[model samples]
Target chain A: MSFFIAHTVHDALTALSDGARPVAGGSDLVVGARHGKAPLPPHLVAIDRIAELREVHHTDSGVIIGALVTHHDIEMHALLTTSYAGLADGSALVGSPSTRNVGTLGGNVMNASPAMDTGSPLLVLGAEVELQSLRGTRRLGIAELWTGPGRTCAEPDELCVAVHLPAPAPNSNSAYLRLEYRRAMEIAVVGAAAAVTLAADGSISAVRVALTAVAPTIIEVVGLVGGTVADVAAAAAAAASEQATPISDQRASDRYRRHTVGVMAGRAVQAAARRAGGEMIPVPLNRAVGIGAAS
Target chain B: MAIGWWPSFSVPSGAYVKIDGDGSGQIITGAQECGTGAVMTLRQLAADEVGLRADDFELVYQDTSVAPYDMGATGSQTLFNNGRAVVAAAAQVAEQLRALAAQHLEANAADIVLADGVASVAGTPSASVTIAELAAQAAGGELLIGHGSGAPPAPPTTVGSTCVGDVGMAAWVAPQFSCHAVRVKLDRDTGVTRVLQVSAAHDSGTIINRVGAEGQVQGAVLMGIGQALTEGTTYDDQARQRNPALLEYKLQTCADAPTVDISFIEIATPDAGPRGAKGLAEAPNVATPAAISNALAQLVGHPVRRLPMTAERVWLSMQPAEPEVAG
Candidate 1:
């Protein structure tokens, strides 16, 4: 029943340590409560106003996106859109205009929905989350952070401060895409993200592929290394379909998800390879490639 | 593409128009304005008859205690039925105004023409009297007030037809007709269908308000798209309603609205509403779902036999048909 607004990261961590749940936009928490998925926590600390947590810092090794950096910010940011295009593609398709304006990267990561647009892209891009508390701070790989659907490994007293993403290598890029019924206000029925690095002779040298909403958590495709663009994309698609452990639900059946996620993985790899070959594809591969609705 | 729908019945409508001392007009009616601008369009009908601007009239409606009896805003009958009554009532006032102006101008009432707030002798504009002055004279003596209850038009008779439980639905009164042709882009891999363009042609008689009529068609087309592809009610094993929230019951957003091209047939007929106009609001809603369904059928090679044909259903329909087994 108690609510506190934290102006600093110190204050937010202190409130978290005192058993207060940290809230940024409350897009998930409030909506979930309204849908009777869960009740609101007894105490809440609003961390949206913390200035340091709202910044995006670029270091020598990688980029550090603040916990409060909204989907709107990440999708529109020039560096993120050009260099880390897959994450930008995922962020851009998060929700409608208003949802993107308020929903933050930290909140989406913490909510831990397997179908979250950002998760698969973050996994493919070698991203990690920085969880902080009054005791200390620690970083965990994005894959290790998610345990199950709507379940994360972070403790209640630890607030996710930022997400760290390694810089892309030369001649490398990534892309993400999802199967959506509508153009806006939609969750991914199934999705995939792929990162690709091309050698001098225009063959894929290193590649990573990840699938969303086809398992208990965002899962990576296995045994994909170096090959021609067509060979690697085809291999990723087959591996994703086989590795997926999807369950039937209202959005899609397991059979449909298994088939479509593979298609999406293959398309993502092709798009990523095209970007790596110096193609200036737009931020969202969905609209650029005409995946959802015709404008 | 598909064509369908007709207005099934008719209802009585009534209205009263009065000219006050200040030359402004007042209309009192039981017709309701349910965001469709049906009742608001009544002013245009009255203005055409009374030879005044639509803004010169003040409307008092949706008050049963004071206004005359109307069937309310249902069945797209507000403008169709109430417009006739409003024109009838305003015509009565027009007749009285011409008679009053003829007396002052020393001319016959038949020769007097009411236009632009002035009553003039047909070809002689100089010999005219202002309607405001005529209203002032009438306010001192005979008041200018008129009322009309337009009788409901009879339903058309149906021949060579037998009905089991006919609730008078076999016949139609001033039936509306429409055809919708839709162009869609569908992703075969994901089974997602997106309507790109819709060209709709409606024979809803004469259109009174072009903007309002086009808006109704566009809005209804969007609704039909939702019904064809996304909106559906799900029920659990106990017959309890599931997916009751907006999150599950998907409605079309503005982003999903297609480019709609609208055209009206503009047919004029006898024994119908004012200027032969028919009921319209619900007619455009009839053909869009069928149009979308037909378009999807062309893409998938077979009909998607379900309402709100979700991507999953469309994908299932596209799977190769299993070979029939010998009994």
Candidate 2:
């Protein structure tokens, strides 16, 4: 019923305290409302014009990505594509070119869809969501922020300001892969993301794996540690399949998702290990590994 | 790959060709232009008979009050039927031009040749007069207008078969044939099939418009791929359609298009449409789904046996059979 355009983070946080929902790109909110999934919120504040929230700043610890940074920017940024290639892979495959241009990482993180392309990659990278309000600011682990499907733990008066990612270990890289029927404008039937750190002997010193579209929220695979690349990849596959609690829907059956997520986890680990060993696999491992179509 | 589709017969089309005093022409017909360029090809047919460039003519079509009656664009018969009528009408104008030229050149009417905007005696290029000048002379007395409705060809006879409830579709006039060979890569883990390359061969008689015909084949093959893998309607137990919207019913996009190689088997038949050309629009659409289905079957060791072999269906087909338990 009412709309406000915020010029600064303080303005956006003040509007949020006044029962206004913050909208950066509105790719999910507008599209879902148009499809009769839900009605638009009565009071809305547009925060896309805030310049401070649209930056990707490098910190001594890692990197700080503003909430309004779009998928197009993240996918094309030199630092993100080189050091944080897995996140780039997820961002590049978000939607069609037009959707990627308008859809932001902040909106994706706040919407908290279990099937979101960026969720698994951010989880595997040990990212944290920074929520700000008129009172103060607080940072929560990415896993803790997502409570359930389409539900987040952040209060109504809080706005997601930035996402903080810790620097990866030396000789470490990440990769994300999804089971998609088409190359563009698709949702992942099942997907996996892996972050692998290689030891001096070309073995996996540490690794983390996460699954998408197989549970209420993006869930990470546990009990994976130092081992050969093959052993870690196999273990990640088994753990992902055992941990995922996917449901049956029109996109895919639960059985199919359970099986394919395992396959995707193994492939993601292998791709991450290859990237860690100085092999230049492309940004999206899907096309490079011949998953979707032949280019 | 598969081959199919027969051209519909006994559909009549009529046209009128009028030549102005300035040698420019107009073709009036009721054929519809539906992005296939079938109606546009009529100008080429008229130009071949009138001895002018295809661009020299203006077309007035798809209006019943001004143009002649046409069977409309359906069953891929717009080109097959309207093309013959256009050629017949243009031939009448050509005959009139030759007669007029014979009078000026003092030659036989049969020996008059029309070429390059001029009418001349068959063996003497020097004995020639421009068609525009002849049209100017004719405009003083006689108006140049020709109308024709070419009779539809009879349907092909059947040899040993007698139908019980024949609705006149049991026999075809000029049957079109095609084969589409598609190479697809399937991910066994996810049951996703991606078409890599397509080689489509069609036998639709002489290809009148090469580029337009090739485009039809390419577009149809993409549609076929959607039908094979993604397009389908789901129904619930109460006979209600579940996925009625496009968001649920998936259609392939340009990103999903494969590299298509098209070839035409040009067979000029004596008893078909104009210049032995048959219907081509719908012929290319018949074999694509089958070609993709066959490729998937070869990979899965058995047919999925569904309209659109979705990833779930293909995965279900590949599952091992359950063991029998002792009672």
Candidate 3:
């Protein structure tokens, strides 16, 4: 078995060319190994030490977050909190403190779990990933990048270098919400994220809604536009329920996931609209909606 | 009919207490801690009896080769049985120290008060000898060692033939009763339930150490929450267990812990235990699942009877009855 500490993106790709798996926090890969889910790859390239893959910056086109940015970083990043609040909220809800400290956006996206907290937000945000190899760099939309549960379309020799998020338009914002049996250390039984742009008339001019743990991949709802927040929210919720193709498993039954994802979608749309309208609100809308037990 | 040997009917246990020349002591027993704070409780009991600070004593436990035979640390029997042995051994050492001090102070052994490891004459404050001085002589070959073995007295021989129906009120030793009340919030949409708070009342005879007792109660209640809400083994159609990993068979996390309030009602059963204390380790866990289920049933307006009332099951229970179908 051979190991490589990639000092640059080129080195990481070179290592991957020899059947080495790229590991950036290794929270997921190492856990899989320890739990006997799978053996560790014979060769591994540690990409976390690469200085370039760890940057989050703003450009004229959009805010670019390096793939290695930890969930803890996203949860606390001031830029994500302002414009991409849904991604930040989803980041905050990822795993426990230890997992959040070591789990990275790159690993989460690459792992391609349908229940990924960041998946729905990235889907709604129209985020794209920059995959690099020795040959060159290629960009793919987040939705196009995933093929199935734990299977991504990215080639073995390609490494996800960064995530690109378009700048939130004027009077636009996003929010993500999920239902869990517990308050922490949970994969979303069903989740929803919404990015809405409000018209000057205080109505939703344009909106994108996405559901997690409700399909083979993050399911983005189409044809949700132009309505009062309540009308828009109800439409989005019902649409998501109809669009969801969840399966019954240990975490939740298909019927429950379908129904709950709809509810979460409705809540996400309303919350995103509220944020787009410039109202100060907390994430995890259950706390604000007074739905559960008072904390 | 004659009574034959009942293997576990009366558990045999032993403990050894040794006070060193420097006043520090060790209590050796075969009881296991199992993270249930048994070691701490034993230390407290031994310290109180020997008139030494709990911190001043060290415990050697769960070593079969060194320590005497115990029934092992099951059924919460460590504190109930082994604790009695510890108290007995420490008392023997205290008595010996008092006898040695009585000779030095020219007073009666019974009148030599053992307090704070100092043996003082009852009426004379100035006449005293520290446990260290007496232990120093013992360490120098004076031969002072305290040992004790404990077992319940033999039972009366059976008189009648093997009886079937309702054999006159069955004898129960160290009975513990506990009631758990919980408040839960059930999300109707997702079927997710969160335990908000748990309040427990226990009758575990006399309390040994309040802090350790509370810890036991709280930990048990948290485990109870797991049993009620999130813990289960899934099986496939072929009768194979599907989820063998920790990820799939979810246990309660710190975030799932609810506020717990515990109160103890002491009704000392002197004949049943040492210091009238009963086995509390299992009592607190027994009633929690029932209480949580009752709360969930009330919240969802349906009797949701199931282990690990997972979100899916609870949601299914909340659904309205389907329309009658024609045969």
Pick the TM-score winner: 3
Model 2 per-residue lDDT tens digits across residues A1-295: 9999999999999999999998888899999999899999999999999999989999889999999999999989998987888999899888888999999999999999998999999999999999999889999999999999999999999999999999988999999999987877888889999999999999999999999999999999988887999899998999989999999777887778898999999999999999999898887778788784552
Measured with DockQ on alpha carbons, how good is candidate 1?
0.61
Estimate every model's Cα lDDT from 0 to 1. Answer: 0.87, 0.86, 0.81
Q: A205-236 in candidate 3: lDDT tens per residue?
A: 99999999988988799888769999999999
**Per-candidate DockQ versus the true complex?**
0.61, 0.55, 0.60
Instruction: Estimate, for each residue in B174-253, the C-alpha lDDT of model 2 and write its tens digit.
Output: 77778888898888877788989989888788888887888878887887888888888887779787788876788888
Clashes of 3: 0
Candidate 1 residue-wise lDDT, B277-310, digit = tens: 7777777778999999999999888888888888
Query: Relative to the unseen true structure, what is the Cα RMSD of model 2?
Result: 4.0
At residue B23, what lDDT does model 3 achieve? 82
Q: For residues A150-228, what per-residue lDDT tens digits would candidate 1 score against the true structure?
A: 9999999999999999989999999999988887898998999999999999999999999999999999999998899
Instruction: Give model 1's docking category.
Output: medium
Model with the higher DockQ, candidate 1 or 3: 1
Colliding pairs, model 3: none
The C-alpha stretches of model 1 lying farther than 4 A from their native spots are A292-295, B16-30, B56-69, B93-146, B160-170, B322-327
lDDT of 3 at B96: 83
